[model samples]
Target: MLNFVEYTTQSALRNAGMRSVISFGIALLFFAATLVSFQVTDASAQSACFERTALMKHLSGKFEEAPVAAGLAANGSVLEVFSSPDGVTWTIVLTQPNGATCVMASGESWMGMKKPKKDKVS
Candidate 1:
């Protein structure tokens, strides 16, 4: 079994990977979308899109997920993380400027982290 510190480290690394995926998705969807045959149909978008409050309610009520981290981008988009209690499951959501909230990704085995302390000098 992993100890708390070790688990936190692992979780942080996994979270970083998730962020990398989000970045890749942004690049693919915004920059190189034309290079690929990717398409966001209205039906697909409708399934994923929701009002911010509604999405929050659904996540909390259905999965017991709560916001773990959230931030706003320069383009007025918001990236938010919702995780189940005990760090077992998680979701990454993006809220666009027009108030469309969508689940960008989700997975299990979320691990919470403690605040990092400054390193000591020898």
Candidate 2:
């Protein structure tokens, strides 16, 4: 009887060790999956066409200003437009352009820019 109990104890220990190893493997797999998902999300955000969205008010003929346009390029989409003389109380209004408003927002980082309009030609 004594020998039987001793052998059973050793077997339990071995089984516990195996279970622990399996748990560790599962944890490693989950960690790897999380890392891969994070990398994919970061790469997609950087590759996207629009880095950020902003609302700009047309100040004058070809000028617009905003508090923040960190990722706005010269040719980014004009999602929204607002205007204010005091820069505090803004009014949402649509303004027309005078000259050939080409895709000027491309390649140039802008802060406050007029709302972009889609070109008929392209």
lDDT of each: 0.87, 0.47
Stretches off by above 4 angstroms in model 1 are 1-47, 119-122
Question: Which lDDT tens digits does candidate 2 get at residues 1-122?
Answer: 55988999999999999999999999999999999999999976652122123223233323443333223235542333333333443322222232212222222332355777877874
| Stretches of candidate 2 exceeding 4 Å from the true structure | 48-122
By TM-score, who's the top model here?
1
TM-score of each: 0.57, 0.39
lDDT comparing candidate 1 with the true structure: 0.87
Top-lDDT structure, candidate number? 1
Cα TM-score of candidate 2: 0.39
